[model samples]
Target: MFLDEHTAKQQIVAFAKSIFDRGLTSGASANMSVRIENAWVMTPTNTCFGFLNAEELSVVGLDGTLLKGLPPSKEFRLHKAMYDQRPNDRCIIHLHSTYATALSCISATDNSNVVPTFTPYLTMRLGPIAMVPYFAPGDDALAESVGKVAAKHAGIIMANHGPIVSAETVESCVYGMEELEESCKLALLLKNENANTLTAEQINFLLNKFKK
Candidate 1:
């Protein structure tokens, strides 16, 4: 069932608190959003998720105009960019989680897929995670870069930033973000250990079967 606007606000606050409480994100370093009808409800700019006020969440038009509540997060463009490109995506969760942020800072010649295929759940939830080059916080270019890959990928790690994941529901988006962070942690743990990763064929089979 679709959540009403009021319930959606409460759900956003609840999920935000959960994210902060579980250490999925800390401080005011993350943003979240859910599309409702023609507008989007989002976390306010610079507000700590742990202490979010349900009434203070921002509601904005698809064109980015602020309609109610506090001002939208500075990363609003980032969220809008993804939504503009992918009609199927309804919720977005952006977090500066510990391990995922660490992986984002790694210098890589090939910045294609940062998270290796270490688990079936990761593959099913996040697909091929892409990497976008660094752009200063609030830069529109960051949004543009994300838009380029958002259609094909369910999640992406911004260079020197962190990850942003979009899914059909807020719950699924949070789950995908968690899967991404865990996969990144696993990748770091297995570094230089010659860990066996899923083969392309195996990954393809999982992708075909799950169709996340």
Candidate 2:
């Protein structure tokens, strides 16, 4: 069911609290946004997710105007960039989850698809995980980078940062983020061993069957 503005606000808060309680993100490091009608309800700047109140979430217009609540997150542009590009995506979750953030710090030559196609679930839910070059947090350049990458992929990992996932609903977006974190963890766990990853054909079949 499509959530109204009021319900979207409550769901955003509830999702935030759940992620915070589970250590997906801590302090005020991550940000979330949910589209409602012509505007978006987003987490406020410097507010801990565990303590978020529905009224305190920021509501921003499509044109980037703050319509209500406190100041929007510094990374609001990153969220906006994705929304501007992907009209079908209703929710965006950017989190500094432990495993994903740790994977971001690793050195790699190929920035594209930082996390290899290790699981069918990750491959189906998230196409290729784009790895965007590091930009100062909140930089307009960072948003632009995200926009370019998000044009082709629903999930991306910022270099030395974390993951940003956009989905059709808040619930699925949260689940996708969790899958991303777990996939990253698995990649880290098998960094030394010659892990058996999915073949290109298998990935292609999954993509064809369940492309999101």
Candidate 3:
């Protein structure tokens, strides 16, 4: 059955609160959205994630019309880009998580800044993450850049912007992003240390063991 807009809005709002209470979104810096009828349901523009209400959420159709509530998140284009590029993505969680955002500021396309280290947990949850270059907030350029990487990842780090996770369910999307942040935090901690990075052989072994 199709999701009633209000129900989906509430879920997104609840998930946003969870993200904020866990110190994910800070101030008015992050937003959340879910796909709906060729459009997207998202938290309101300029609202704090910790206090979002369904009624305050907005709906933007595929053609970019504001069909319900207030104006949709400033990153509607970002959501649209993912929807367009990734057919399986039903929800998207965008946040300015501290550790992940910190990693974004310094990460590169190379696995070194991602989950290259020997960690089965990160590999299982993130699969392969992507790092997109920074773009001005709310610019179509950001969406365009995201389109190039969406097909390659379940989670993406917006260099200097934060992270966005696209998944089949809102819950899984949030969980995956939490894993992404934790893995990034671990990577940051081991920076410059002699901690053994995950070798191709070790990663392949784990992959084969778990069929990941």
Q: What are the clashing pairs of model 1?
A: none
Separate clash counts for every candidate: 0, 0, 1
Which candidate number maximizes lDDT? Answer: 2
lDDT of 3 by residue, 1-212 (tens): 33668778989888888888988778988888888667788888898889987887888887989988998778888988887887767788888888889988984758323555557776666576778888988999999998887776677888888888887777777888888888888888988888887788777776566431
Q: Each candidate: what lDDT?
A: 0.90, 0.90, 0.80
For all predicted structures, in order, the TM-scores are 0.97, 0.97, 0.90
Model 1 lDDT tens row, 6-64:
88898899988999999889899999999988889999999998999988899999888
Clashing pairs in 2: none
RMSD of 3: 2.3
lDDT tens readout by residue for model 2, 1-212: 45788999989988899999998899989999999888999999999989998997999998889999999999999999998888988999999999999998987667777787778988888777888889989999999999997877889999898999999999889999999999999999999998899998998999899786
Looking at model 3, residue 168 earns an lDDT score of 73
Worst ten in a row by lDDT for model 1: 107-116
How does model 2 fare in lDDT? 0.90
Reference-based TM-score, model 3:
0.90
